[model samples]
Target: MSRPERWIRLRGKPRGPRAFRRDLAETAPGLGAGDLTALLAADGDEILGWGLYHPSSQVAWRELRRGPEPPDEEWVRAAARAAAERRRRSPEIDERLCRVVHAEGDDLPALVVDRYGDLLAVELFSTAALPLARLALPELHEALGTRHHRLALDAAAARAEGEAAWVETSPGCPELVQVEEDGIRFEIDLRRGHKTGFFLDQRENRARLRRQVAAVEEAEVLDVCCYSGGFALAAAAAGAAAVTAVDLDEEALAMARRNANLNRSRSIRFVQADAFGYLRTLAANGRSFDFVVLDPPKFVPSRRERERGLARYHDLNKLALPLVRPGGLLLTCSCSGLLSALEFQERVRQAARRAGRTARLERLTGAGPDHPVRLDFPEGAYLKALWLRIT
Candidate 1:
């Protein structure tokens, strides 16, 4: 489809590099979200960059380029190659399972590619990104040697970009496939599960949790919102004294149970309940753990839901802090890209104050090395984690 030429004018100074509708001085009358065009100044003298006009989104359009280096077909191909080459060069990341393309992190905004064993799960988050990503499937297969591809979109992203969320796989690729991460096996439900059926971004965090649990003698662990039991299983394998995994999704819990058995573990107590309520119950019952993981799903996917999401984070930490025995560690995480690491840390601190617990920050981390973030696109630096020591 031929893209229409529109005066993509900038109006206000955006806080970050991203441009929202409020920042836009003008938009094309009939431009599609994925349609590429040059950005302009209000006076129309400067061509700021290129963008994918996303009218349905809060972000009118994310910057595709800061210069006139067109994101043409060749640019897309090079991006695909560069993204793949970076992952292949990362000796620290397991090739068996890792993120190959991290949207804006790879300079290809709104498109993510995750490799699970033989399957490549491609998630397109914007109309602008969707076409470019689709056009590069052949290149991805050639570079990665993976013919099995599953392309999909989450509901929120789909709605924001005015695109239909779908699940389509290459011929002969099963909807459910088994993949290994750091020697632990997991079953990925690409068609039904959330965000490509696994949280690959938390790979390093899980490893760190395992190390923490194994460091202590007879360490008791609590994993809140333990979807598919990644942290719980890791802790169990580390020989924790006891591990309690809690989540609201029955299906995810069932999978977690199966994973535990696969790892020859009968010790993990898998509880199906709301994490918030469960944490409150555990605290009221005077239950405590030597280590705890609060890996909740994204409480806020967009800026509009930021208030409620921050509240949940604050309250969750408040309840969870009491469960950590003195000198124990609490690894709390937020996947909401909208929440800055500083803001998230403040939330935890506020929660600690409310709970009357002394919490000191020990380490601050984010997604594994596989999920690299671009320097310009700080938005790619979502997934903030705070490792705190409770006294």
Candidate 2:
């Protein structure tokens, strides 16, 4: 009948420690004993993921995947292969730089697979997904036809899961390779450069930026926090007269230079500098552009840092708005999960006001459709983009 009713429908009891009974109250507090039992059963189809649930924590599951049949090597390989196939069809995605297996998106929880050129990067966010990663590696290699595989275990996800910390021997590919999106190529490392190498979730936003770039006739463009030049390349391709791409990462700036060249856009100038410093420099120089892009990384990681992050965002736009000529465009974004969309916009408005610049909101967008957000789970909606016109 209804979506919520259909989703709640379950059958039978799940097999686990008797402690699971005790955990029900603490784990999924709102769910009744019967509802928890039905969740475990899965109507006899077998669950791909299960375990001690922690509804309170951002990570809600201890058992990533389980089934009627043992989830062994074959199953792991098949799952990895299936996930890769799904990403292969997306024209916007560079197969080399993508989320081959996006945890819940691929029906595999606590697992993330990123493809960087010839290398494959794997990160396990939960204990249940670790063994599956080892089992699935060979299959991932076979499916993608790449031997270079690197496992990144730097984050604290392991500690939270009560698992001993283990150093990852492999770091996916050796040298970074070029990943092209919308005629823009970026060199991405399997070992570093944000989540699983590159921000693949910003595919649609980059495309939208490109379209706006194409409409402007010889517009001067500024791309702040120009990680690997995704937005810069798009603007350059759209024929921006002078595109200045700024980033603190030397490696990323080098990649951005290559990306500019790949698109045969000589009009772009790559600058290696802190985004905030660069904005201040622009303001001091009294330089203004027809288009300004502020796509910084996550400023706030948790709720505690939200106010500081919001303040940073406000100050960033305050400096950036003055660098945008009146009647020009400002594309601002926030990838912080800690901040909500309304709060981000309010911060931008505050920034515009502080800069003595009035603006009209043109558009409000989020992560691409591929990175779908479940109606019940707002955490999935992380990226927020706003297009504004300086008045």
lDDT top scorer: 1
TM-score of each: 0.95, 0.75
Candidate 2 segments whose C-alpha is farther than 4 A from its true place: 1-49, 52-82, 88-97, 126-128, 138-147, 156-173, 261-264
Which one wins on TM-score? Answer: 1
Each model's lDDT comes to 0.83, 0.69
lDDT at position 165, candidate 2: 47
Candidate 2 to truth, TM: 0.75
Global CA lDDT computed for model 2: 0.69
Lowest-sum lDDT 10-residue window in model 1: 1-10
Residue pairs with clashing backbones, model 1: 34-128
Residue 44 in candidate 1, Cα distance off native in Å: 2.6
lDDT of 1: 0.83
lDDT of 1 by residue, 77-154 (tens): 888888888888888988768998888787777788899877899887765677777766778788888869988776
Model 1 residue 62 CA deviation in Å: 2.6
In model 2, how large is the Cα lDDT of residue 24? 35
